[model samples]
Target: MTILLYDLVGRDTARPFSPHCWKAAMALAHKGLDISTVPTRFLEVPTVEGGVSKLVPVIRDGEKVVADSFAIALYLDEAYPERPTLFSGDGGKAMARFIERWSQLTIHPYVTTAAIMDLHAMQDEANAAYFRQNREQRFGKRLEEVMAARDAGLGAFRASLEPLRSTLAYQPFIGGQSPLFADYIVFGALQWARIASPFRLLDDSDVVAQWFERCLDLHDGLGRKVAAAAAAAA
Candidate 1:
């Protein structure tokens, strides 16, 4: 059976390489699953219209539609049980689940904010225009309004980093020595934030920085894919 992933190739605002999606993609890649990506602009339209819901990183295996990143990860794990398991046996699986929840509820917002600020700083005019056009297309509102909403979202985003900072202090990976499903989810969001935007929040945090580097190393091939996408976008 073919695995189809709905993804965004590069810096498209509507279908940005969200961590949630990244987690599923990386997991599938790591498992050596037969996968193909179908690029989409905004998740909500394809999800709702296509019956996948507003959730990104939807994985379709034949007629089986797996929505939600975490759910998709679990499905992939069941489909392809292999070495380098995304989740350890029992306890590890529980921990992985917790990390996934934490990343979504806490870490993602701050990383996203930092990324946006970073992107704005590096390529303000171009990025702004890109964001405006994308937002207008997806949200159907004035660019200014979207920007204002983004600005307001920053406070919560900043707050999200604290849990990650604390979590990383103890473990190399989110779940422990080996990266589990949780790491992939968090990494995707962090990577998107760092890559699409310009923020280097990882710069100051030694543990988080090291962890991020490790994640890049783990999915070196996917990194190349992302680089190629960025180049193509450029």
Candidate 2:
């Protein structure tokens, strides 16, 4: 049976942009599992799968229901031992934990700022209102004001990726020759940026950007299935 993934989207349901949801999607692909996605929006999250969790990236497999990207990944690895392993082993699991935190801290904030307004634009009226109000309160400023700082934040964001860039210089993927859950953890962040905004997050010359291109080609261009926001508009 194909697992059902509750993937978060905006007005364009074809584009699933949530980083967490991307992680789950990539994990499903990595495990070689057949899956279908239910396009969910911000307002619909509460009602997904009978309100399983406050957040999305929910998956229903057979009689089982799982939420959260990391939890879903763990479930897939355990349930389908015959399939490709997401973490590979206990050591890989620990490494994935670290990478997840690093990506959240070092990458997410900048991407959030850069893409916030565009993301809001992608929402329907009701969702846009909710997004603007909630985010303004969270940042204690208007969305435009928050986005203004993204230009300044870009340098820091690029510099912060030095560790990842250096690692990629030596290996094709964070998982060595092939991608593991660790790769997906970081890939999810960039994929979120790619889908949400037209602003170029990385320079063409940067190894990180090159690595991202390769990732987009994975699983028969799974990431490429959803065009970058700019490309979609063009």
Candidate 3:
């Protein structure tokens, strides 16, 4: 049976911009599983699979419905042992956990500030209003005000990626030779920024940017299929 992925999108259903959704999508691709995506808007998320979760990146495989991108990846790996492994073993799983936390703590805040308004712009009017209000309440500032400081934080953001840069210098991927779930974890984060914002988050000469380009070319250009906001507009 084809997996049914409830992927988050904004006004453009073709653009599934949620980082978590991208993680699940990439994991499914890595596992060589067939999938059909259900483009879910913010407001429509609560209605998916009868309120499976407050968040998206939900997948239904046969009779088993799974929520959360990490859980979905775990499920896919266990269920399809014959297919390509997401985490090569227990050690990889442990490393993936660390990388996930590092990406969230070190990478997410910067990208959120950099792309929050662009994310709002992609939403429909209703969702945009909700996003603006909710995010403003969370951040204690308007979306524009939040994004305005992105330029100042750019250097710190780049510096925070030194560990990843060091790793990429030694190997082509986070998974060494082959891309793994760890690669997808970071890829999903940057891919969110790429799809939502025109901001240049990384310098062209940065190894992190080069690594991302390599990731974009994986799964037969899966990440590249959704053009960046600037490219999409062009």
* Per-residue error (Å), model 2, residue 224: 0.3
| Candidate 1 lDDT tens digits, 1-234 | 668887654444433466667888888877777787776554233543366566577878887888888788778777777646777676767777877777766766455334543443333355456655764677566644444546556555655566776877777877677778777877886777755654345444456667777887785557434531232233
Tens digits of per-residue lDDT, candidate 2, 22-115, equal 9999999999889999999999999998998999999999999999999999999999999988888999998899999999999999998999
Q: How far is candidate 3 from the true structure (C-alpha RMSD, Å)?
A: 1.4
Model 2: residues with Cα > 4 Å off, grouped in runs? 231-234
> Tens digit of lDDT per residue, candidate 3, span 108-177?
9999999998999999999999899989999999899999989899988999999999998899999989
- Scored by lDDT, model 2 comes in at 0.93
Least well predicted 10-residue stretch by lDDT in candidate 2: 225-234
Local error of candidate 3 at residue 225 (angstroms): 1.2
Q: Between the candidate structures 1 and 3, which one is better when assessed by lDDT?
A: 3
The superposed Cα distance between candidate 1 and the true structure at residue 3, in angstroms, equals 1.5
Candidate models: Cα lDDT each: 0.64, 0.93, 0.93
How far residue 79's Cα lies from its native spot in candidate 3, in Å, is 0.4
